[model samples]
Target chain A: MWQYEKKLQYPVKIANPNPKLAQLIITQYGGPDGELGASLRYLSQRYSMPYAEVKGLLTDIGTEELAHLEMICAMVHQLTRNLSEEEIKGTPFANYFVDHTTGVYPVAASSVPWRAEYIASKGDIITDLHEDLAAEQKARTTYDNLIRMVDDPDVLDPLRFLRQRELNHYQRFGEALRLTSDRLNEKNFYSFNPSFDKHCNK
Target chain B: MAMKERIYAYDFAIVEMNLYLDTHPEDKDALCLFHQYQEKREQLIEAYEAQFGPYISNVNDVQGDKFTWICDPWPWEYSKEV
Candidate 1:
């Protein structure tokens, strides 16, 4: 059994209700490259990962993504906490309020609803590991952008925490890739899997 | 604390699952933990529905007569309620 923590992995408090910023940040919640997709993808893909280290990395990163999901939801909630119908209808939040009424709905800034296409779950370990690496980098870039767009200490506090997590995840995933590569080397007794043929035999 | 617990349970499962899988990828120990976490998650979800009205607004699964016993009373209404 896992123990629960009362505190967020990082503190998240949004003092002002900026629905527009919240709407934009919702992209990190449910966009194609959002934390939701990131969490689900990594967690689901772990079983087939060849190396135990890589599998562990997926689980760790995926779990953190879940926290990120909550942080984003909190942001959205704070942003629209007291939004009136007229206020909501006057801004892009109108689209969200029509459906969720202050509730967080996952989607990119482009308004594309959450889709499974965001994740790449090839059964092949090599392909999947490479994809995981790229995904971390993508998320890091997104956090950097979010940090730049928002300047509130409340918002910046969580954003900074999340950005640090991105870097940590990137470093871990990079190590995982190395571990997987080492496994391939030991199994082949060769320098590398040049053709990618053996591992690609799906 | 209730909302935080819900999130933590899910995250705890993810972290524990990864750690277990790191060494015992198929040890079944990790799988057992996975099941435990999932069950806890269901209980938390029920608790959430009971207290917060509903975690998801459109869904009403609290009526026991209906097959939607998924909702449990929120923490404030726990047996420890004042």
Candidate 2:
């Protein structure tokens, strides 16, 4: 039961319309390490998580990722607004404009549409948490790459904010991993899947 | 717009504290901070909605005719001043 909040997680007011930049930023919308994948990964993995802390973390973080996804779309929409035919004629966005026409679509900079294969929901708690840790790092790297290429302060502000969030999420996920492992067998955390092997301790 | 920014800031703090508390559920200080921000956030939201229509769909502060929920300039819509 999600409620709609008619506001973005962060404000994205791009004074300049840069379709080229939009093409790049849209990658975060549907890229391999995009927010879409991040949200789905955590939300889907929560069902199999064995600990209360892990479950709550996944739900909260997953919801925040959805907010991030909306922010990304707002960026893309603002960047591509009011483009002329001439403006779209020579840029890489021409390919996208032909299909979407100033509309935002979830596709990578390379024009790959979003797919579920970008995420993993392993039923094992340790494996799933590790997967989440790696996912956060990858998303942080993507934001870093975006920041390096962007010069607009308007765009850079939100990118920096989102990049910081990735770091925070990584830290939280690391804590979640530590908390999870602390409850498992001290010698071998992977000896049994706590999510499924209920009687292993006996 | 200033009110909206205040609401955003307070809400942001609440969200950050929420994620922190998720991992550190027993931390009384963090929980206290979370509640404080939440209280301020409610005040900000009430003030913002009074002047700027509904911040969310459930606010239900419509007046006169027309459903204001479908108002122009959705969050995604481009505006020079946003």
Candidate 3:
């Protein structure tokens, strides 16, 4: 069960509010590579995970993605909070507002909504764990690019926190991949189901 | 409780239960904990719907009302303004 701490994991303070930059950065909030999809991808993939550790890793990292989702939403919200309809509509945010009404929606910068196509859940422990590792790297790269584009230290603070988390999750996912590899029969990959009891997999 | 924060916690708990159960499904004590967590989740969802808005997104269509709850504030509103 979750417990709320009544405070941010880290505080977000924008010395300035730039709705235009907010519009672009929000892609990380809901974009294909964004935190929301990452959380959903891992959480939903846990069902068929062959090993307990992989399933556990998905859950922990998925939960952290949810936290990252909160942080990204906080960034976008704080960036756009004080803008007027005229000001918001006047800038790049105008298109976003037309679609989401300043809501923390999940969409790419091109205005494409997030889709299940963003990530895959292969279900095989090795395959899924590998995908998770790659997902973390992809997300880390996205954050890196966003950091380059964003000049605000206020924005960068949380971005740095998020980047650090991505590194940690990557490390865990890498560990999960290794564990899954060890579980696989060194002889062959075809008979992954020979040992475990089928009736009790659930 | 603030609606969004409570709902967030509720979802977090569900995911937490799902994860714990993934590893400890046979533990009766853990199962009990899962049930307790779920019951609390149901209560919170109801409270959130009654006080704030529907719990699901997009609950307008007749078939849509099938989902019952929709559209709480997004998570960012609960954060302190930067």
TM-scores of all candidate predictions against the true structure? 0.66, 0.94, 0.67
Give lDDT tens digits, candidate 3, residues B1-77: 56655655655666555655554557798788778878887887787667756544333413343533323344345
lDDT of 2 by residue, A73-157 (tens): 9999989888789998988999998888887778988999999999999798888988999999999999999999999999999
lDDT of 3 by residue, A1-202 (tens): 5543333445566657778877777777678788988988899888887677776778777877877787788778878877777777567788888877767888777788888899897656666766788888888998898888888888888899888777877776776666555655556444454224233232
Candidate 2, after superposition: displacement of residue A96 in Å? 1.7
Off by over 4 Å in 2: A199-202, B49-59
Error of 3 at A24 (Å): 1.5
Lowest lDDT 10-residue stretch of candidate 3 chain A: A193-202
Rank the models by DockQ, top first: 2, 3, 1
- Candidate 1: which stretches are off by over 4 Å? A1-6, A186-202, B1-82
DockQ of predictions, in order shown: 0.09, 0.65, 0.11
Among all windows of 10 consecutive residues in model 2 chain A, the one with the lowest summed lDDT is A193-202
- Candidate 2 has a TM-score of 0.94
lDDT tens digits by residue: candidate 1, A142-161: 88888888877767887787
* Candidate 1: CAPRI quality band: incorrect
Q: lDDT (0-100) at residue B51 of candidate 3?
A: 75
In terms of DockQ, the best-performing candidate is: 2
